[model samples]
Target chain A: MSLKMRLGLVFSGALFLVAVAAWIYQLKEGLILTNMQNSYSWGLYISGLAFFVGNAAGGLVLTSSIYLFGVKKLKPLAKLGALTAFANVTAAMLIVLPDIGKPIRLYNMLLHPNWMSPLVWDVIVLNLYAAAAAIYLYILMLPELTGRLGWLAIRVDDPHAFSERWAKRIAPVALLFAIGIHVVTAWIFSTQGARDWWFSPVMAPDFVSVAIAVGTTVVLLAAALAYGTGEKYQEAYRALGLIIFMATCVHLFLMANDLVIHSWYGNAETHRIMDIAWGDFGPAHLFEVAAPLLGAWLLMRPQILGSLPRLLASSALLIAGVFVHRFLIMPAAYNNIPMTMTPFGLPESHWSLPIASGRFLPGMGTFLDQYAYFPSLVEVAILIGIMAYAVFLVLLAIARLPILARENQ
Target chain B: MKMGMVIDLEKCIGCRSCMVACKQHNAQPPQTWWNRVFTPGSHRHLTPPALGVEFFLPVHCQHCENAPCEKVCPVGATYHAEDGAVLIDYERCIGCRYCMSACPYGVRQFNWEDPEKAHARSEYQEKYHYGYPEDHRHEGRLVYSPLRPKGIVEKCTFCAQYRDKGELPACVRGCPGKARFVGDLDDPDSDVSRLIKSRNAFTLLPEKGTKPTVFYLPPKAKEV
Candidate 1:
């Protein structure tokens, strides 16, 4: 293994252990360890779920599209893309274990599943996405694996031809599942009319766009770093960059379209809610917009695309940007109850719900009109652990498997 | 029977008796209120809004006929009881808090920690673990317990335990001003129905279209 990969594994392994410890402590103490109260019930953990799901969806979708469309340029990176997707979807599922109040009682979600809840659909899609990505990845690696472990294999005259044929059939299924996973995730928020921000038609399609942008970013970054960004892979890099940029622009347009309507609603309650994203949360929202655009711009620049370090940084920025977008989903939705919408003639000051903050603050007031949530130290620790583990897995897979041998050195 | 509540905003003195009584009988944990009295548009509970008159708007589970909480609970933990009340089965809940988010009224509260830890803070509570000291089950669902299990959702069951015994809810009985009433909302001749009809009754956030069973009589230039 490379020094960077070894260092990453060690670092992530250490953090993942710490995350396990923190999660155990959290389970022992119940959700009291979390900053989430009844007021802001869903927090950083849910954001992580959304962000990682988008990453997972984006990766596999890119891989499958290569087969479906027969995009020769992206063919080489298909294995790595599938690997990334498999790892992320797994991480996405694991992270949700900590977010729930009774992690042990998760079986209840399966045994007594309510078909009406979008969350149940999310549970199914996420699991299905993980399983399919794994199978899809094995197919991508079949030729290489058969060569290395010849004794165990039924020899195909052309292993490459056989695997490619299988990959073609799985491509459409994987692509549709990727889209399904994202739509289900978005519906987990959107189906509920209680949250004004989430109850929109655009959330699902917008999530798909975001998945495409961030997913391709991961593939681009991984391909550039793993195989080395050389003249041989120039066309692939260009195509991937265009995909990321176009998808990101589409995401931004939809977001802006939603924001414009909110701005024009011409009501005090809406203006106040809009002020949350436009005012107090402006810096975070600003970063959400600027990072992806800058990163996409860097990749689009052919000179910067060749610079491996620049490619890595752009990918990091784009990933960070979408993560922020996932997080921004909660604030406007959770910070205020939509019930505060006053009658047509009532004055503008229909206040935010004064909700009980579950944990005792010693001397501080327990009730808040509008609570600003920051993840507790334990929550942050667990989040870091999950992300690091996903990174470690992706790196380990690429290095260990002879998977990328067909591509450039 | 479509059981529901009708609270007259004018008659409530902001005494918090109903809030206190509900807490006592229902055994809510620290900082968890199934029934909360608020002065609407005020920064603090019971504080007057810009309207200058300090009237109370006590809120709880509306027990909507088209309940969002019931629909959103992934485990079918939250359900509409036979009496038209939205209820949670503590044993069945996965504590996902989806129902908490789905409720527009914001009445749902999760057990952040053990109920005993909540009781430890107050000397009075430490000595006396109040509420009806029994597990009340309806049709095999553990709807009410003296202390709910940690890591699950709980909310107003409209005093299901007391109602089963043919008694008024703790909140309704404890209202010193007699401002609260409960009856079969489905029955046209019921007291709650007549009160709702006569008093310009409204449910909170009618625009939400949850079709709340609980009604509120908006104060119409009345001095209590």
Candidate 2:
């Protein structure tokens, strides 16, 4: 086996082992292994869920380049990005399974769904988006499949097959569908009026912008990894950096806007959450603030980060920034000011403890473990396995199929 | 017919016995309850400290006729029974927590972990046992001792189990202040029915259109 294949197998196998170990520990001890408690039910799994969903947003951006704007240089990336969407949504779904108490009976969500709940709507949208994303990528690849497999698309191949014509013809519509998938995902969270943190007019756009930034970053990383034998994918890499740079600017603006809203509103919940972001939840803040700032600073002068090493480092930093951004948008939204607790400056005698009230506070440990959900080693292995498998699958499809036009010698 | 609860804000002593009784009867965990008491925000923050931090409102799932939670559930897991009680099917919930958002009153709670670990005292056990006819003791011990399962949403049921037995909810009987009044809206002769008729009762967050069944009678205006 080649070195790349060997590395892929080793990486996948190691992740598999760790995930399975975590799963077993969680199953035996229940949620006690994790720190998730009553006050904040959502932790790492939910955070990962949001991150993965956001991660899929770039596939749409890639689709737009090829189908919407007729940018042919991105044709090589369309199938690869679609495959990433599939891998990500799958990872998100599996992570959520262990997060809930009754992972065994998860089917009840579909069997007895609550129509009005945003969560239920989320379930519908996630599944639909996954299906649409998968099909959109596959349909675009049909022509490629027919050219290479011969037997895959149909038994016999005609050079000018009608199916080939249809595949190219409808590719634009599939691209549009891809854009809808992530936009609707943003709406699901934004519509919740109770949590002031999530109630933002720009949340949908923010979600789309960051998705493209991270997605393009991942594409660049993958391209560099593929060219390890010293080949240059310079054109695609340059385009990727430009896209990331622009998207990073949008992403930063959105973050500043959210803070501005919180300060301007000065409501109890909003201000309390702002305090948590700066004070107790400092690690996440560090990631969100530092990574992007450094990434942008390093990449700000394109000439310096133009080389492969600089590009990879910048991508890594940006990816970390996006991860912290995911955490900010998710778990932090659950902050509340318990009406039972006396306002901080109140007199001691006036401290009236209510007979019954729910108290909200910052939970301990990595937010993910609190729900008693530690992603099982099996889950992590599967996640790593799927990602490796996706990379492998995309590479094989691209190499063997006509996903990219044959280059002249 | 509208079945509801009337709480006299002035009479509440905030002893939290009602909260305890709710957990005891419902077998809920210590940190979790369908009913919670809220001491009114301190009026001391006002320009003058004349107003006192007077009343504590005990709240639960209002069993709203126009419940926001019911409309938002994608799976239709939360719904109202014919007798005007909001109900949940524990076995069916996916724990998505969308209902947690739809509820403006913030009553619904998601079970982040298995509830059994936190249920310290099993008061629900007593209600399930046999009790006397004349007194609440006639009812049997509360059979439901198990805490709520994880990955499902749970809230107050207005003691539906006790209602099925033609008895008052545990909190109604447990209130030492004698401030709670629960009755069938269909029965005009019931004391609660008369209280609703005589007193100017108001539902919290009525503007949200949940049409909450829990009514409040603000402290009677002080005599001039």
Candidate 3:
């Protein structure tokens, strides 16, 4: 390994260790250590779940679409996409362990699953997606594996042809999974009528669009990192950049559509949610919308896409923006209390329900009608740890696996 | 056999006895109240919402026929009893808190810390634990327990320990204003059913389509 790669592994390994320590502390103390109370029950960790699910789904979608669409120029980068999908899906699954109050009782989710729940569906889809991603990655790498191993001659008479045929068949299936994973994840939030902010039909489509945009960005980063910004890969990079821009446009339109509907309706619940999202969490929301747009704009530039540093930086902006987008999900929905019943047909008579925060500090308000929730230091540590784990896995796979084309070629 | 409650707002003094009775008998740790009462406008009790007339709204688990909480519980932890009461199995709850967001009334409370650690007794009340110091199971599910485990969600069981024993819920029994009534909503002759008929009772957030068993009589101030 290169000196930087060794240093990178050490850094991620250290962050992963810190996450373990924080998780242990969280388990012992209970969820109160996090800022989430009854009102803000879904916090940063849930956001992380959605975010990484988007990443995983997007990465796989990029890999599988290449085979289905026959993007021969993008073929070298397909392995990176599959590898990221595998690693990120694992990270998404691990992140849920810390968010749940009782990890010991996780088996209950499987043993006595409530089919009515969107959460149960998400659990099932996520697991299936992870398994499918692993198999797809292995098959996509089969030709490479068979070439390197003489023992593989017994199993397959023609490994290259077998891989080509199988990867093609699996591509459509993996693409369906990509759509299914994000749709199911978005449904977990949107199915609830309680939080009107999350109760829109548009959310599912928007999630898919965001997934493609973010996933393509992931592939682009992986490609540029694995292969220098040489003329050989320039055409493929241009094609990938176009995918990110178009998908981002779709995502933007969906967001604006939701915003117009909410603001136009102008109900108390709608007004309050918009106000909270824009007012208290304004900067995060700004970044959520701005970063990806800017990233896409930069990718649209012929000059920027030609340079490795500029390409990676653009991808970083997109990732950062989407991270904030996922984090923004909690505040707008949770802050707008769901109790909108009018008493005696008088809207003013409807009182704000101050939810018990499931926390008590001597001087603070114990019951909160609205809360501006921020993740505690412990939660932040764990979130970073999870990101590091994903990074470590991606770097390790790239280093160990036959991810890039053979150097002699 | 649909168990429910009806709170008469006109008779309610907003004394918050129901809140206290619920907290004590339910063995709620600090920062948890299965039932709470507040005026419409102010944090203070008895502050009128409009027309300078005082009335209190006591909100808790609605025991809805179409409970969002029950629908969203991934593990079948929150389920409806045969008697139409929404109950949670503490042992079954995975502490995901999805049900907390799904409930419109915001009555669900999670044990953020170990209940024993949070419910630290003061010197004046040495070694004395509050609530019906016994575990209460309904239909083979551990629905009500004094020492609840941390991380799981808990809410008003309508005092299941007392209800299962053929007694009124503590809130209904302890209300000084006699404002709270509990009985079978399914029975035409029951107090809750009659009150709904005679008082033009309504449930909170009816538009949510939850079909809550609990009802409330509009405050007389509206008529005035």
Candidate 4:
């Protein structure tokens, strides 16, 4: 293995170990270790899940589009995008495992699933997408898989013909599943009538638009990183950068529309959530807007978009911006505590006790008090570990899988 | 028949007897309460208010007819029971806490730690007692246990155990002020139904459209 690969494995392994330790501790103690309170139930983990799921969309769209549209120039990059999609969707699904309060009882989701719940729909769609992505990746790699392995050589007479025919047939289905995964996830939040921020009509479309932007950017960055600034890969880099720029523009437009509509005639709850976003969490909002704008500007310059290093940096910024956007969306709405009757007096005589020290304790008077949530140390560690694991999975695939096709083909 | 409660905000002294009774009956973990009493006017706890709204408002699971929490539960862990009360099936819960987020009233609480450990360290340990023992079956059905295991969502069950025995909810029976009335909301002659008709009762967050069964009678000026 290369030194870079060796170092990456070691780093990711260490992170995975730490994550495991944190999860074990959480399992022993329960979710009390996290900063999530009754007011803000879903926190960093759900946001991470949403972000990663969006990241998976780029690969699916790119690879499926390549097949369906017969984009000859982008044909060589199809496997890379498909593999990235497969890895990311798997990572997205895995990250939520630790966030579940009863990880062991997760099977109940399938066994006694409530069709009315958007989460159940999300689970089904996500799993179907993952399966489709995997099959798509495997079908794309059938030639290598069938030829290299002796046992597999007997199963297929012409691997190339088999892969070509199968790939053509599966592209449309994969595309549909990819779009469905993101829509279902967006619906999970939007369906909640109580959450004014999430109940917007623009949620699903915005989710798809942003997902395409981030996903394509990730693929572009990965391609640039692996293949370097060679003349052969320049066309792919420029094409992806153009796609990212357009998608980011759409995402920004939708964001503006949502903000305007929300502020124009929304309820008091909506105004309160918007206030929190623009006030206390202003930096995150600004970063979400500014980073993509910067990336779009860079993409307008042909020279910068064509160059590998510049394209990689621009893509990185866009991806980070979308992530911040996802992070901001998840918790901002929950900060508006629901209407409750204020206590006649403090619940306890003393406020010095550790339990009573919470900022929005029960008897703190008003039900509409500002609620704050920041992921605790253990949550941060687990998040870091999940990211590292995704990196490790990508590295593992690149090293073992026939992801990079021969240039002549 | 739909079971529900009618709380007289006029008579509530904010003593939190309902909260204490719930804790004592359910033996919930530290930092978790199925019921809570809130003072309305000020943001700071115990601050004397100029608004003259001195009455305390005790809030718990409203047991809504159109429950948001029930609709959002992925595993059907939370469901509307036969008597219109929302209950959690602990064994089926995946602990995603979607219900907690969906609940506009924020009545649900997740067991962040083991109940045994929380009970041991709790200041109210002396008052804690299990309403039903673990693995103790009653009449061929597993008795509802007050102690919840770690990592599951829990909330008030409307005292289903007491309801099954034809007794009132612990909170209603324990109220020093005798301010709470529980009965069949569908029954015309029931106290809750009669109070809702005669007293100009109001439900919390009517805009949410949860259709909460709990009704509140506005406090009189003299009471404040």
Question: Retained native contacts per candidate, as fractions?
Answer: 0.71, 0.34, 0.77, 0.60
> Tens-digit lDDT track for model 4 on A1-409?
6888889988997997899899999888888788776667788888988988998986676765587666567777787787778777877887788789889988888788898998888888888888988888788777886444434432667888988888888888888889988898899888777778888889999989888888887777777667776788777676776777788899999999988888888665556777887877888899999998798668656788667778778777877888789889766667666653333353422111011111123344223334567788998898888878777877777776677766522
Q: What are the chain B TM-scores of all models?
A: 0.93, 0.80, 0.93, 0.90
Off by over 4 Å in 4: A150-154, A340-369, B44-48, B120-144
Error of 2 at A78 (Å): 2.0
Q: Score the docking of each candidate (DockQ).
A: 0.64, 0.29, 0.67, 0.51
Minimum summed lDDT over a 10-residue window in model 4 chain A is located at A350-359
**Would candidate 2 be rated incorrect, acceptable, medium or high by CAPRI criteria?**
acceptable
TM-score of chain B of 2: 0.80
For all candidates, the clash counts are 0, 57, 0, 6
Tell me the TM-score of each prediction against the true structure: 0.96, 0.80, 0.96, 0.91
Q: Which candidate wins on lDDT?
A: 3
What TM-score, to 2 decimals, does candidate 1 have? 0.96
In model 1 chain A, which range of ten residues has the least summed lDDT?
A341-350
Q: Per-residue lDDT tens digits of candidate 1, residues A1-409? A: 7688888789988998899999999999888888888888999999999988988865565665686666777777788888889888999998999988877788887698999998998889888888889888887777777555565444688888988888888887887788888899999898888887888899998999999899889878878878888888888899989989999999999998888887898576567668888898999999999999998888898888888998899999999999999999989888766657342224655655566665575665767557778899999999999988888888778766755865343
Q: Candidate 2, residues A109-168: lDDT per residue as tens digits?
A: 667765555566666666766776677665666655644375666433553465446546
Clash pairs, candidate 3, are none
RMSD to truth, every model? 2.1, 6.3, 2.1, 4.2
What DockQ does predicted model 1 obtain? 0.64
Candidate 1, which CAPRI tier?
medium
